[model samples]
Structure formats: C-alpha cells, structure tokens
Target chain A: MSDEPVRRQVTLANPNGLHLSPISALVKEAMNHEAELLISFDGNIANAKSTMELMLLGATCGAVLSVEATGVDAEVAAEAAVRLLSEP
Target chain B: MQVRSGIPVSPGVVVGPTLVLGSENFRIPRKFVSRDVVESEMVRFHNALDKVCQDIEDHEILVGEQLGSQYAAIFSAHLQMARDPRMVGQVEDAIRNQSNSPEYAVSRTLRKFAEQMQNLGNQYLAERALDIFDLEKRLLRELLGESREELSNLTEPVVILAHDLTPGETAMLNTDYVLGFATEVGGHTSHTAILAGALEIPAVVGLGRCLAGVSGGETVILDGDHGQVVIDPDEATMERFRTSQARNIRVSERLATLETLESETLDGQRVQIFGNIEFPQEVEQCVKRGADGVGLYRTEFLYLGGNKEPTESDHYEAYKQVLSTCGDRPVVIRTLDIGADKVPARIRDRFAESQNPMLGLRSIRLSLQSTPLFKVQLRAILRAAVHGNVRIMFPLVSSLLEFRQAKMILMDVMEDLEDENIEFARDIPIGMMVEVPSAVMLIEEFAREVDFFSIGTNDLIQYTLACDRSDPSVANLYRSGDPSILRMIQAVLKAGEQYGKPVTVCGQMSSDPRFVPLLLGLGLRQISATPHSIPRLKEVVRNISIPEAERIATHACSLDLARDVEHYLLGELGRLCPDLVV
Candidate 1:
C-alpha cells in the first residue's frame, strides 16, 4: 500500500471530454481499483468513482485535468484514468 | 416482482403490458406513510430500485445490440446512479425517519439532485442533466403512471392499473385498446367492475393496497378469475400462464365456432338471442356473437354520470352506433329508466327524494315527470330509427295508463319532429317493460296497446317478492326462479301469444344457462342478456330440445317453494350440461 498519492497530469484528446460516456467510462474503470481516485479540472475536484461528480467537472475538448490515486493500486488506477481520459 | 390481491370483478386471464393511472406531478397520494407502513414503504422503495435497475439493464442489452457496446455504456451510468448510495441512501433515510411514502421519498431525493445538476448553469451539463430527470420518470413509471385524466390519449393497447375509476371514466373506456383493468380500491359492484363485465374487459378491483410497488409499462398478469395481479411474473408462472392461456384459447375457439350457429332446438324451434348492452361499443360484441339484435340498449347511462341531460346528438349518436352495427336487425332502445336519485346531476335535486328509491319515481314515472329530458331521448331514438330496425320500450311501466301516457309523450315527440319535417322512422314500434307486479297483473290490457312485451325479470322479482336483490342477507328471497316470477313471465308470454306480438325475457335470469331451458319451456321465444353470456346461452339453447325445456319449466313451475324450483332447475341444467352447473 502506498502512503503518497500518485499524480499525473493528462489532457483529454477525445473530442468529447468528460461527457456522459467518457465520465461513465472513467467511473467504471476507477471502481475496479482498491484506491481513492480523484480527477480535478479548473479547481473543481471530483471523485473518479462517482459518475455525477466526474461529469460535474464539465471538462471540454483538450481540457487538462490532474488524476490522483492513493492506495494499494494507486499506480494502475491513475494510469487507467489518464489513459481513459486521453482516448481520442 | 410485485403482487396485489383484489376482487376479480370480471372473469378472464389477461397477460399484457400495463399503463398505470393515478396521481401525477409527483403529487404523492399520501405524502407520508404511517409508522406501521414505513417498513413496507422502505421495502417498496427497494423493489422499485430493483425494477429500475432491471429496466436499465434491458436498455443496455438492446442498445449494445443495436449500436456498439460503448453506445450502451450510458445506461450503465444510469444503473450506477440509481444504486448510488448518495441518492438511494437519502431516499431511504426520508422514508425511515420522516415516514415519507416511498413515492414521496424517491421524488424528494431525485428532484433535489436533479435540481443541483440543473443549477450548475453549464449548457452542456444542464442538457445532460435530462438523464437524471429521465431516470426519475423511470422510477415513477415503475411505481405508477400519470393520472387517469391522461387516459383518453392512450394510443396503444394496454392493461390499466389504477387507484380507482369513476363511473364516467369506466363508462368511457375504449374496449378496443384497454384490454383489462385493476383498481386499488373498489367493491364487486364498483363502476370499474360492473362496466368491465358489461364491456367484457377482464378486471379486478378492491385491491386494498396497490400501485405503490408498480410503475407503468411492465408486463402484468391480471387474473380476473382469481383476482390476483402479478407484476413481472417469474418464468415458471409465465409458463403456467401460457399453458392455461392455450387451453383457454381452445375453449374460446370452440365457443367462437358456436358464433355462426343458430339458437335452435333439436326439433328446430328457433329462438332469437339478443344482447343487453349498456354502452354502444358493445354492439360489436353482439355482432361478433351473432346476436339476433340488441334487445335491451340501456339508455340511462347517457345521463347518469354526466352533470346535465345528454344532448339530442349524444342520444342520437349512441342509438345510431348500435343500430348501424345491427344493420337490418332489430335494436330495441329502452328510454331513461334511472331512479330519480341516479338521474343526471343537473335535474337530480328537482325531484323529491323518495324513501325507497326503487319503488319511488323511477323508470317511466321519472321520465313522465321529466318530460323535457325524456322527449330529447325519444326524438333521438326516432331520428336514429331510420338507421336500422329500432323499437322503443319504456322501462318499469307499472300501469296501462302509464304505458299509454308514455306512448302519448312518444307521439308528441314524433309530432314535434314531424312539424319540423325531420327524418325519422315514423312507425317505430312502442312497448312497455313487464317488470313491476302491476305491469304483469294488467299484462293483457296493457299488452294490447303496446307493440311488444319484454319481461324484465330483475325488477319483477324484486317488486314481486318485496326484497332488495342487492341485500346479501335477503338474497335468497330475491330469487329469480321464484314461482311468482315464472308465473308472471308465463302471463306475459300468454298475453304476447294472445296479442300476436313478440315477447323477450331480458334480465340476469335470461343470461343464466340454468334458466334458459326453463325460459324456453315457459315459451319465451326470445331473450336478451349481457353480450358475455349470449355465447354460452346459445350453446345451451342449441343442446336442448323445446320439449325438454318445456318439461323443465313445467316441473319448475309446479315446484312448491322458490328453493325447490331453483334446486330442481339447477339439477335440470346439470343434467342438460354437466359442465354448466359448476
């Protein structure tokens, strides 16, 4: 288990960013990990495992957000979030 | 997964999609549940959640099949949001602590979250917030649909689940689309129940608690025979339902084959079997059943439920519908016979309240008193008479003078139409209902002036035996097979025989297969009963010879007590067709 939060900055390459599908996909992926996942954009932070909260971030095309994960699977959880959000 | 027990008012098994009708606009019927129902309400809430989750899963599969799996991912999000502890937790807390009804708890919790999403003020996000509102509608539809007020706009065939139905609402139901109906609160004789029987729609009523666990559009199994409503029945129950339905269809097909058969005895004595209908829509039922004609088209319904007297067109169109449906077949229209208490609301107070409304100013007496209202219906019957064979009969004519006076009013209406030179059947046959004891006592004198005689056995037995038929305690005394009733019917038949006019027995007794042979033996060449009973009555009529029926009636009439007569008649019917007695 990691004590320090693993963080990565990612830009959404997909044309529709943090929209209904992507936000839902991120939540589904984030729920797979035993870690606390958070995605922050424009000073608005949302729990990566919550679809409504993640959607409320309202990130648009090419929007840059920070993905942070902390727990046993922090590394893979952050990597999954970054990879899912960066999908074109 | 929800089941409700109600009184099955109409007999049939209905497995179809449901359209629930009740309170709308998140207007919870009861905002709060009592402490006792709180646990039940909470359980009800979970059931709704489970139902909604299954629906979202179904959409996922369907959408995934049509488009790619990614396109179906949105429903997955909805599924998650529905189970989200934040939403469902709050809903449960409200139901548990505040005693809110499950419907109210869900509405409050979801609306709060939906409003939060909407208030975010981002165009893209606000539009996506519609997903939340859609989810809310899904939950409500799982519990119950919108109001009964929206029922008129139904464009598809669906069963109805409702809290209750008013007489007007039940009367106006379209038999074409509304396959069956069940209600949360109502008795065996409620409007929904009686009208369901009259309209031949499967129905269950008096479900003490319902609609809370159901949302609209679910496949419902309304077992009107057992008065059970099972929502989302298991595969096993559905399999049983299908097998029984197949057997029922076989029986129906056999009866349907009888549709084209004649109502004749082995000796070839022909009888005319007509339908007694309350609504014009039932004329199609009569035609399908091969009824001779509509022998009793009850016209009081046009007035009873409404605030004002039915306009001339309302009366005309209904008669026109029935007559045109019958084509050249005779359609007998009974004029307004509603008791003064049951008259249209506008003129209801005008008549003095009678102590015993049944014996009071009712039927021909009420019509004679309210000539203006009575004349409107008579004119319509005359105008629509040109459409097909239309005979006008006055209901509950207790005296010859009352019969003649009703004729005088009919003649007056005829003259008014004549002076205006409007088109109508000038020679429409006029008759009196042989229902009251006096009507039978003076049958010969009254039989001469009237063109025909139809023994209305229901009221005749009620008045003859001096018992209220609806009173359960005295139900035995209100026997239809009472000796006095048979003798009265015999007298009417004899009068018709002497006057050379046709006579038809039109009542519940005529519909009973047990009474069919007895009626035939009493020399009733024709009868009119509800459309539902005509098929079986025809089957019974076909199986028995006139001589057999004559023997049954003679033996029944010779019996000492009403009990002996009824017992003997049932034995005779059982002997005729072992399947019918049970």
Candidate 2:
C-alpha cells in the first residue's frame, strides 16, 4: 500500500473541547483505520490515537485545528477526524 | 390479591389504583419467505424507520432548543445510522437466512449485536447497542402496524404499571396525576429508576412477571419506600394508605402558604429560609414559595446540563440569571461538585477513573488541583456576584489548608482580572460545605476561617454509614435521622455558634419537613432546600417555638445510639402533630 499524508481543518463541537470522551472517540476512529494520525493546534501536535497526547493539547470548545494522517488509510482517517470534530 | 416487591428508588408512600400501561409488540413469524414477500417487508421496514426518524427529528427541534445542539446530535446520529448502507445490508442478509420479514430480521439481528456488545464491556460501545435496538424496535413496530402506546391521562391519581419505561417516556409523565411507578423489567440502576429519582416520584422497579397479571384500574397499593405493590387490598390496608396520602396532600398544602409568610417561630424569632437550586428555572419556584434567597446554587448544573464544558460566557450567563433573580437576597454559588458519577458531559476529562470516586478527585480537591478550571468558574461567579448578592462556596473542603489554598487561587484569579481592568466582587463571603467527615470532625477549625458553613447531610449520612446512597441493599443504613448524623449536625451548629458565623443545612435533608422542627430544635436558624420544598419547610419552622425545638434537640443529642435518637425524634414528631405524618 502506498503511504500518503492528508490533512483537514475541523472545529470541536463538543463543549468539553478535546477532553477524554471525545479524545477516546477520536482515538477509536483512528485505530479503526490503518494510518498514522496526528492533530495540531496552536503549534502543538499530538498523536490522534493517543488519549494522553490529545488531552495534553487542551483543545477547548470552538477551537479550530488540523488533523493529519499518513499511510494507506490517510484519506479515510482525515475524513473520520473531520466527522468527529463536526459531531455535536 | 397478589403482592409483588422490588427496590424503591424514591422515598414516598403513594397509594392509588393501578393504571397498567400495556405495549402490544407485533409478532412476525420467522419462516422461509419468498423473494416477493421479502420485497414488501423491506418496504414496510423502511417506512417504519422513516417514521421513527421523523419522530426523532421532530423532538430534535424541541430538545435542541432547551439543551442546545449537542444533545440533538444523539438524534442526528441516530437518523444517519438508520439509513446507513451497512445496516441495510445486514438486515437483508438476516432476512434471507431466517426467511422472516425485514422488520423481524432487523430487530433480531440488532438484538444479537446488542448482546454481543454487552459482553465486550466498553461503556461507549455498549451504549450504542441501545440506539441500534431502539431503531430496530421502532421499525418493527411500524412494519407490524402497531402504534406506540400512549399513557392514559387519569383525572384521579393512579400508580403507573408498565413492563418497562424508556427515559423519554418517563420524562413525559404528568407529575400531578402520577402517584408512583412500578415496572417489571428494570433494576434500581436503570434509566427509568434514575429519571424517577430525579423527578422525586415514588418508583419501584424489577418486579418480574407480576406486571402482566395487574389489571387496569385495580386498587393497587404501591409502597415506593418498600417497593411493594399490593393489589385488591383489604379495608385496613386501603385505609392506612388513604390516610397516608391525605396527610401528604395536607402537608403540601400547608407548606405552600408558608412561602409568603415570614419564617418566624411562634415566639417571634426571625429565621432565614433559602432554597437550594440546580437550575435557573427553579428560581420561579423559590419566588412563588417566598424563599428569602438561594442558600446553595449548585453551579455544576451549568457543566452537567450538556456534553461540553460550559464556556466562561455560559457560566457567567447562568450565574447572572440566578443572581438577578435573587435580587438583594444572598445567593451562595457552590463550585463544581463533579465526581465519577455526577460529572456532566462537559469537563469530565479532567478527572481520572478513580476506584473510589467519593474519596477521589472532586469538589474543592479537584478545583484546587486544576487552577485553570477553578479560576474560570471563580471569575464567572465573582462577575455574577457584582450583578447580585452572590456568595462563593466550595465543596469537600476536608482541611484548613485546602480551604486556604482554594482562597489563594481565588485571590490570584481576582488579581489577574483586576490587572485586565475587569470588574468583579472581591468582598463576597467564601463558604465551604461541611460534607466530608473530616470537615465535620474539625468544624471548629473550619468555622474559624470560612465566612459560613452549609452542612450537606446527604453525603454526611452516606459517608457516615459507609453506604452508597444509590445502593438499594444498604439504603436502609443511610438515614439522616441517625444519631450520628444528628450529632454531626449538632456539632456543626455549635461550632457556628462559637464562631458567630451563619450556618445552614442545604442538602436533601433540608427539604424534608419532618426534619425541619428537629433542625430548628438543634439551633439551626438557616435552612436551604429545593424551591418546591421551601414553603413547606417554612411552614414547619413557623409553627414551632425555638426554645421547644432546642429542648427537643438537646433530648435527641442525649441518646446513646443513632437509632434511639431517631426513635425519640419520631415519637416527638408524632406527639407534635399526628396529622403531619406522610
């Protein structure tokens, strides 16, 4: 499989921001796809599949961030991250 | 006569004729189906799914308006999942293998997945099973041409009897006519039970198959305190229950008039009566009941009401609303009391999974640990304090050092705001709830530093009894009337006396009228309860003399055991007013 990187801008709809529950949701989605996923905001980057890393990002509500993934499932990972961010 | 028993989820003795709410699920035979028949069943299933989706969509507008868009997302997801092609493929495969109608096949397949998900043991994944089954059931009902059963509107009070109740269904109940509830399928921890407890309605759950035998309009006696449903009772049982119901009605009516009247003892001692509120809507109830002010405005509701952590603006708006409603009346805003069980959808991430959450990171402990979250809530409350007579309070302050540390953080936040040229109240009195046993043990030290004390008896009793209030098996052990609980109350009251600081009981026990005289007797001059209970508590307070109450309290304290003290108080209560028994 060809490895590629793709990124998308998403806004956190959850009020708790990038807290444990949403981070868990995002991590689960990232784990489902065969891709290396990462999210960045305010010059800080975190592995999308690592709850501890995502939480350290301190992404609060209404924060705009970019989720990027590389590998065969990068496109699907990007799409799923966008979906997670868009979820209420 | 048949009597069935289960766990009582709410306290209250309600007696009324039974109103059996029957749901007729359509039986679609599982047999080999021809291609043509499968096609028709598929169309029916889709039609049903569409209708249910439309129903959810309709509710979305209403619920969205109240709880905001986040809650509406649950339905939005459901709508999308209903039409997911993967689910469609699964349903088709099931129908082909079983030769059943599309709706039956879908329901059975979803049930299977739900069972499998249950065994997986992930809460997030397991919760999704309900959505799948709910959608399938909706589709099957529609395909089978069965309408959702609507609860009957009874002009007379009646006990609700159903096989099971959905959270939404229980939410829609008319509180006025529904005396109590009994269900056959749910346990004490079920959604129905939780909702019932929130509603403060008497409810009994997990009675097994006995619900099927109950007929509509049967003179059923639902003892919510014991979770016993008595059908076709003899005259004596009927009379006893009727009298209890009459007493309940009479007490409520008497309390209703107390809101507007000054809460002065018969000897003319003025006492302050405040209401404990969880939401802004309760302010109206407080006003109608003539509450002097809000003693404990639990600020956690702003966090708990939705999935996301409330913004500073959200916190400010809610605080402003409550403060504005109170006008000059003092409103003590307690900081977040979030624990493992009580964490709102918002800000739950800050907490780690604690094996013993009650003793874990929560209340002032959690607040002090996180400066950012603590400061945001503090700044918002301080700003709102400028709008009205708002006071700031902290929960679970186990030590004097913790109290000082919290105050230091508040001072830091205030200084930062001052540097920004933002306005806030710096002179607001800071108080702490004396819920933790350690706090109570050292009330004198705590009283010396804090401006006030609000005794949270619910947790006090729970911690003292070492019982989880939600645990049915040990629920009997958790009683505020226990001598140990009364002793703690007395200790706190005396500490307030020594320190000359205002003390208030602002827990579930405060709303309980039976305890009002006892609280007054214990020299507790300030009581805060729910808005609905404020008037009744006021009535009880107004009827007795402070000296008499003090005498009773002294007598109560003299008892060697908690049970004996409770017995003495109950006997005194009976002698005081036989008609007041509820």
Candidate 3:
C-alpha cells in the first residue's frame, strides 16, 4: 500500500467563514472516509476531523486552506473536503 | 447619587437596597485541581454538560410549544454548540493536562474560543460569541454546585434591578419581598410591565444602561409614580423620598377605606366602576378593590398559554370559574380578540398573510372566519352564564352587519343549547365594542341593535389617529386625548343617551387617573379598568361634580390639538383634586 498523501488547496467561499456551522459540517464530512485528514491555514495545521482544531485555525472567508489526506480513500476524502469548502 | 427616568408602568414609591439579578456575565471562580482528582473533575464536567444539554432541550420544547418552531430554533443552536464533541474534548483536555478545575477549564476554554470568534470581524459570527459565553456561565454554575438564585427566596424586601426579565421570570417573582423593580430595558407595553401592573408592583422599565452602575446591597429609591430611580441619594434626597413614600402609603390606606363607598360625584351623580381582568384569579382582586362588577373579561388569553387551539371544555371551564368567582355581580366577557402580533401561530398560519394585521383580519373578523372556533367560545359563554350574571360582548365590531352576524351566531348556539336542553342564559345581555371609526359613524344604528356599547378607546384612538400604538416612530400621534378621538367618543355617548342604551369605557383610558375627570365630563358613567386603579379612579370620581366634568368635556372637545387637550385635562385634574398624584 502506498504511504504518499493526497493533497488539495481550497478557498473558503462561505461569507461567514469557518464558523461553528461550516467547521462542524467539514468535520462531519471528513469523518466519512478512512483517510487521515489535516487542514493547514496561515502556517497552522489542524486535524480536519476535529471541530476544535478547525475552529482554532480561524480560516475566515477568502482564506486558502491546504487539505492533506493519507489513506486508501485519501483521494476521495481530500476531493470531497475541497469541494465542500469551495462551494458557496 | 444619580437619577434616571424611565416609563412608569405601575404607580407607587419605594426605597430599599438593590437586588441586582440575572447578570449574563457571571464571574467564574478559577482553581487548580490535583493530579489525583483529574478524573473526578472530568466526571463533573460531563455531568454539568449533560445537565445543561437537558435544560436547553426542555427550554427548546417549551419555546416551540408556546411560541412556535421558528423561535424554538434559537435553543436548538445552543444545544448543538453545547453537545459539540470537539468543544467537549477541548474542555476535558484542559482539565487533565492543565490540572484546572472543571469550572475553570470550561470557562477558560469557551472564553478563548469566544474571543477568537469575536476577533473574526464578521458581525453575525461575532454575535455567536454571546451564545458561547452564555453556555460557559451555565456550565460553570452547574459544575460549581451553584444555581441561579430564585426570585422567590429573597428574605428582605428589595428593589430588583436587572437588564431585563422574561415573562416567566417576572411572573415567578415573590412580590412579598419585592418592593419594586427597575430594568435596563423594556417599553411601557412590554409583558414585564404588564405583569408588574397585574401583580400591583411598582416598576420602572427602560432605564437603559444606568442600572449597570447599581450594585447589590446598594441603597436606591424607585419612584414608579414618576418613573425615576435615584441611586445612593444624599441625606436630604433620602429624607424627601421617605416623606413621599410615606404619603403614598397613607394615600393608599385612605383610598382603601373607600372600598365600601359608592362611586359618586359631589353633585350626587352615580358612576359604575368595574374591574378589567384577564384571568379568573383576578376576580378576587376585583372584589377586593370594590369593583361593582367585572367590566372587561378578556377571553383571548384562553387561546394563548397553550400549544393548540383550546377545546370547548377549556373555554367552558375558564368561563365557569370566572362566573362563579364573580357571583351575582355582572361579568362582561369580551369574545376572543386575537390578531396582529398576538395571534397564536397555529391559527395565524391558517389565515392569509396580512401586511398590516392590526387593521386586517382580527378580533370579530377572525372569529367570524373561524365559525367553529367562534361557536365553541359562544357556547362556553352561554353555558357559563347559567352560573351567574354573564354578558357577552363582541370586540372590534365595525359595521351593523358584523354585529348582527356575531349576534346571529350566538342566537344559533342558544338554539342548539335549547334543543339539547342544556342549561344556559336565555336572556344574556349582548353588547358591541365601539372601537373602529366605522363603528363610531354607525353608533346610532348599532345602538338600536345591541343591548349596549363599550368604548374600547385603546384601538379606537389608534385607528382614529392612523397610528400603531406599538410603533415608537408614530407613538406620539397615538394619543387617546386627541380632539378627534374625544369627539368620536362623545358622539358614541350621545347616541347611547339618545337610545337609552348603557355605554362603558373599558380601555386603558378608564384606568388612567388623568382621564377620569374628562371621561366623566363626557357623560361616561360606567368605567371598567385594571382593578388596582379602581380606588384612585373612585377618588377622582368623588372629587368632581358632573357640571365641572361637563365643562371640561366641552372645552376638551373643542380643542383641535391632542397636546392642548392633554394639557387642559391635566390642569383640570390638578385643580379638582389638588392632593391627588396624577
């Protein structure tokens, strides 16, 4: 099995930023796959499945975030997170 | 010492140490926990979380049932935030790693998150910080084994100072130890103000941020008669307030002696002073205040305070209790008068959306549209009438046709009762509330059809002035003392006299002491008002002669400006009763 990670860059499109609702939504989406998800914003990396870590990132509207995943379904999980984050 | 003024809801003067309650920003005590007790601390944290979640859920259901699902969504958001696994994990981590007390950990963690949210610079998201802060306080309070002090536990009499109070909180206040209350927010017509009036507690609301400066145990004087709050007054100010308070007590005691006396003017003219009540329990208050009868028994409250539409038995039980309480004294029950902002969501959703509900389908209009609902209330009134002297009145009857239609419904209900051989009041006196301008124009025609007329000045003035009373932007124009409104009332009274049909003023105007003389001068011999105002109204009634009132009424009717009319009435009331507080 390959150990290399799948990664993508997504810009926050929600006018409200990564507030409780959007962060919770992201966490719920991240937990759906077997991939280990990590989101990095402004030099701070947070576990994509942790609401507290994502909220602490304070990734507001228009901020670009790096989503990295490493597992069998890493491609699927990373793609889904990027799409959800970029959707207005 | 400083003084601030607000809207006076109930009339009286009180001086006591302030009891500042319901501060949303409660201080959380922080402490360090030993390594051995870390597990216990986590348990305590989870227990507090569980309790808060339960409370939020219960409150959500209550708000959902009482208001509707729309308003109940607010509590749901709180519950979601509280139950967030990430937030819970963060708090527990703080407790174990930092060795912080569960209360401290929760407070610090939530505060940090809230601060970050506030810094996000989005107004809507920033406001969410308040929810987080509220949850933090609730959790901390629960973990610390502290519950919010119940207003019922107050030992010494105090003047309660608060930012604001919900209707439920206001209702649960123990009036025995509550000398008065002053709030930072609320208008004259707010539910807290209404509850204060019902409980006969002097209250000054809408004092703004000035109450924030007041601390618990600090001496403050609340003068609800003038809507003034004096914080930590000097000796001279204190002395003056004490004298004023003593005078108020003496005046009330003296007025209480007039309970048994007939409400009569100096020239031997008789006036009927009746009590306006919302609940059956207020009947005892009406009797205590020496009301001749129940002037206005608002039946709409039966529809409210419940989730679904009230059944016929619900109506029958409420009406029966009120009738039995009033005994033989005539109880005038006004039919369901719901509309505007007050309509229950269940019934409200059934009707077409109204742009302006106050002027739209409301009161008799809504009742007529929902015939089955209307008939249930009518049947209940009829059934209750068998217990005592009960009269039915239809509110907001604009035209003779509407009046006749409502009467026809009542007649049909009576016929059904007769067929069933159910005992009912065969000859119950039915009346129409003269509120709309159209009703005023058709008063003479209405007089011929209805047994009597009751002037509901609250809506009449609002409609006549083309102003919504609740709209602060136009509130200045919604004066009951407007010359146009006065003329309209005089017209109704003249028609009543012409047709020999009795007319009563059963609005806020009847309860206002300033308008008592003017109402009497307008030849309104019957007044139904809040029970607490009856004694003062009777005092004003006994002080003036019919000739004097007629003179004031003539002059007031001629004035074109509402301000001029109000000035003239105030001056006349002051002259007639020099010692009376207007």
What lDDT would each prediction earn against the true structure?
0.80, 0.74, 0.81
Better of 1 and 3 by lDDT: 3
Task: Report model 2's chain A TM-score.
Answer: 0.92
Model 3 spans with C-alpha error above 4 angstroms: A1-88, B1-4, B15-146, B150-173, B177-193, B205-221, B229-238, B345-348, B351-355
Model with the higher DockQ, candidate 1 or 2: 1
Cα lDDT of model 1 by residue, B175-197, tens digit: 78888998877655333556788
* Model 3 lDDT per residue over A1-88, tens place: 5389987999999887887667666777877888899999999888877665676687789999999999989999999999889977
Tens-digit lDDT track of model 2 for B1-582:
778877776667776667666464233333246776766766766677778879888877878999998887666656555655446666777666555666456655555555554444545554655666577667766665644334643466777888777655676677888888888766553445655754667888877656433335557888876678887788988888888778777777766665567889899988888887766767766777788899888765565444567778898999898888778999988998766456654566667777887788877888888778888898898887889998888888888999999999999989988999999888999999888889989999898899999998877877787877555466557677788888889899999999998899987677666787789988888998766656656666667898888888888778777678667776776666554544
Which candidate's lDDT is highest? Answer: 3
Q: Across residues B133-206, which tens digit of lDDT does each residue of candidate 3 receive?
A: 68877886787565444576677788888878765567677888989898877766555676687788889887
User: Which pairs of residues clash in candidate 1, taking residues 3 or more apart in a chain or in different chains?
Assistant: B141-B215, B141-B216, B142-B214, B142-B215, B143-B214, B143-B215
Kindly list the interface RMSD, in angstroms, of each predicted candidate in the order they appear.
Answer: 1.9, 10.4, 3.8
Candidate 1 at B100: error in angstroms? 15
Q: What share of the true interface contacts does candidate 1 keep?
A: 0.35
- Candidate 3 global lDDT: 0.81
- Listed in order, the DockQ scores are 0.26, 0.02, 0.15
The estimated TM-scores of all candidates read 0.62, 0.62, 0.68
DockQ of predicted model 1: 0.26
